[model samples]
Target: MIVMNRFARRAAYFLIIATTMGAVLCTRVLTSVHAQATAPTTDKAVAIMDPTLISRGEYLAKLGDCAGCHTAPKQGAPFAGGLAMGSPFGTIYSTNITPDRQTGIGHYSYAEFERALRDGVAPGGKRLYPAMPYASFTKISDADMLALYAYFMHGVLPVSNRPPETMLPFPFSQRWGLFFWDTAFVRHERFKQDDKRDAQWNRGAYLVQSLGHCGACHTPRGAGFEERGYDESSRLYLTGGANDNWFAPNLTGDLGSGLGRLSPHDIAAFLKSGHGAAVHIVTFGSMVQVVEDSAQYFTDDDLNAIAHYLKSLPAREPSGAYNPQSQKAQEMAVSLKTGDVEHPGAGLYLAFCAKCHQTDGRGVLQKFPALAGNPTVLALDTTSLLRLVIEGGASPQTLNGPPTRKMPAFANQFTDAEIASVLTFVRTSWGNEARPVAKRDVAVLRGKLKK
Candidate 1:
């Protein structure tokens, strides 16, 4: 009877232990969920910052392209958050970053701000997807970081807005799921100068390798979706790769589709102005968006260093060149543009594009960008030109800003072959050698039109 009683006592003990463990687990999870659901900060400190500091912060903020992420697309107040950024798992919407006391960063302490930038961790410890690019911001100098905070706090207008819900797949979306990713991926710190490099090189490195975060888009990500080791440490530094069906060209100084020959001045000019004539290329696709908000406002010195630094970067062969010389591709290029009739494509271009973009293949400055030596036409990333053709053209929005006559979209007026012919004629007409795009290419792109 006594032995039976002892056995019962032991059973009760085990039950109590199990109950305790389960409660602790439940508490931990609940706390995490609660924290993620509520990210609250006030704007008092931000409101108190000096105007000069805020101005400096404003400049740095522009450099960071804060509007690119924080701003809502088309409908909402700027930086009030409604932009839907797609990730492999699902869509992650940007959060409100305005100075709003109730809905934004008005109350975040400097430390909290720094942690978020460097570690991709939200104030209450939510993991931001790499889409936020805290990985690159991790390397930003503290000075710049402070200035950015200041600008957002005082220089900019505030909107009482919160981002829409961020959606992710089941367990993957859980805030707890982020714990593993955070532990594995995040390293909160700024860049330390590489003593081996010169001051100019180091400064340039800091900007591109860190604040510019060029690699988030330019450098390829790994299977886990983190940057392929976020710095120049890996040879894949600026090497190109395909992401989400979009191709990122190699930025290493390789001559073919790379910026090998651009002088520092050229690089600076291109970054500041968005037109690089010598390379016969212009920023397009997402890059044009970058110029509209960020690079154009950079100081000339920073621009030069970036240019000098990028030009100095050695060229890399990311993949075998899609040789136009190949038997199949070469034949394909020839068949697409027989130039059979004095066609409407070339005819229309002769009537329209040639006047501003002359038959001599040069463009009228401030009126039309040069097509002859224009870099966008020659780029391996013809996505820009194609997007321009389909969606119409865009002029640079810079210090001088665009003169306001936006390129009109001609989605309905031209056939795929006609569009291809006009582009081919321009590319080949003025020593600009590129593969002639087939009607099939245009037809393929036509299917993606939103309108």
Candidate 2:
């Protein structure tokens, strides 16, 4: 009996070991695959310095949005690097991008930076994660590339904040796996001018398709993070994208349904200030950072060129903006409760909003947009619109066309239910016709608040 027991115990120990080994193997395999799926191709990051070269690098850095991603929040140093970005996969830490000899890019040569920016390859040929967006930067002109190199080498102060590693699932931790992902998805291409188009259009194309990485946010992603469409070839290009849980609106020429309301100058103005009367609506969510940081810094001519280029793109029909006059909506309109004047939503609106947006639901002219007729009230997905209603409002994107004052958040005064009711009432009232919002959505958004 003792001999038999000893054999059984040994068998059980071996089983545990096998299980653990299998798990480790699976993790490694999966991580490699995940990394490859999103790793940037052709890493070329290097450390080198020349006075003239550094000046050129500065321009490239601005166009590339280097500081926005690499700079730590509220730090006196510029490119010290420690920004934390949240993605569907996990949190990605921006590395030390400064000229610090011991801890930053000081060790890298010009070729290394170029490779990192264009090829997505790090030193020793390790792959960079796709968050760097070198896939887009590869389209930059050689002159612009020199400018960018100059900027990083001299203009920016370097700190010693090495960004943290990403916290992806086990299978995604392997750096080598990023190779496969790049192989399948990444394509190294140069921006070729259309023989028929003018200089402005070509410049806009390069900006949109390359340095700006506009598609990173505006274009939808296919399986494995391959952009659904890289250029105008795909109908899905720049029509919209899902970003940080918010849907970026379509930029196509769908005048009423998409960016049709924006004129070229208006688009330029909006990109400059985040508000304009052409659209007269403000956006929240991740785009707030884009305008506040990168887009606002663009030159007038560049902004105008972008607007003209976008205006020239074809408008595809987006199915989201359903007509509200269907039989179902008409019935719901009749179903609204009439005797709720003293209800929480109505009370809040009367107490706080009546001065500017009258009790009848009409707001002042260009000074204040009428919520009754606003398309924002009529969007099928009310997430952004609801946010605006409860958060007070955002400043108009236009600098000159409209007033720039923004609505403030009201998290302190009204409860979630009250906020929902006010938003629902606006959707159903004064000729607007979108779905009503729920209190739970408000509660969920509330959970995302910093305080």
Candidate 3:
């Protein structure tokens, strides 16, 4: 009787949600039809595809990192899609953006492209998932949108690659449900210039908030999975967020886990080469892809602007601090030289880590990233660190950057408890003051990685 009652309750709950979503969807359809019918048609002249426009579009595409998502690794042609993006609901495969009539956006008009990029509504009323980052793309200016369209239509090579269909389960599978999601969460506004701010800052803001979509990864999400804040207007903007098991650390002016320690030039250099010489920090995880595919190609002026904008953001929810002359750091250095394995993970650090990351936790410049004050090491969330240690990672290969340096995995070398202890030691020692990593935390992550 209890099991039956529980099943009945579950059914009723689903019914309520389904009924609400259906009603909302129907209302949206009617409203959309009416809006389209009533909307005045304008016969705007299409601009001639000049070299300059096409070149700008190509640059914009890189800035947007369109290839990052659309180009499936070792599988699909550039922008031919088939990339499987894992979401909370299920796997959402990227659609082919190449100019292939049957399989891509070849049939899409500028209007259709605009709607899809800005409003998340594709042709035939097909709703794109938020995984597309249209919310941020919506801020792109009219001129920039035109350039992007021109590039996609004329500059890019067409491929008739039909990527796998993304069929998420039940409620999430219902594309119409996103109508309400858009209405409530998406801010349908173009990039607005701040009269008070300089052109450089505004340009940086436009690129970061719109084409760059840095906030898509850096900004925290709300209950509906909407970005908590779009720009610097809200305190939560760029304070850090996790995506695909890696934590994109805070980009605000927080001394420990943010860009606070680095100068504007350092930030620009980091974007260009994936190495911040000022702080001895290097890109890891998904950021390596960004640097390789997008940021490395950015013009010097634009990189500086981005760096300036990031530098301007005030600190929020600050945690962790680094001091090179701390007593703990001194003691650790002494212990390492004296063969004292007194500290919990000191012996392991000497045996495994000290060779690359020096006894003092400072790494080789432009080769291995320093562990002492590295933002990834001091981040509140230990997911990235844990994964990096267990699974290993490589530095991005860039036009000007050093040859890619690989970190070896220790999954088989150490036990979960040992991993946790080493991480905890690293986090706390060498003037890095962050929380400890528990054995359970390491075990949970390891188990997840296995599957």
In Å, residue 320's CA in model 1 sits off its true spot by 11
Candidate 2: misplaced stretches above 4 Å? 1-56, 317-381, 387-406, 410-420, 427-451
Candidate 3, 136-226: lDDT as tens digits: 9999998898888889988999999988999976666778767767866788789999999999999999999999999999998775678
Which ranking of candidates, highest lDDT first?
3, 1, 2
Winning model by TM-score: 3
Question: Tens-digit lDDT track for model 1 on 235-261?
Answer: 777776544434556777765456655
Local accuracy of candidate 2 as per-residue lDDT tens digits, 116-147: 88768776677788888877887777667656
Clashes of each: 11, 48, 0
- Which runs in model 1 stand beyond 4 Å of their true positions? 1-52, 73-78, 86-90, 169-172, 178-189, 240-250, 277-281, 318-352, 371-375, 401-405, 420-440
lDDT of each: 0.66, 0.65, 0.86
Report the candidate with higher TM-score, 1 versus 3.
3
TM-score of each: 0.74, 0.74, 0.92
**Reference-based lDDT, residue 267, model 2:** 75
* TM-score, prediction 2: 0.74
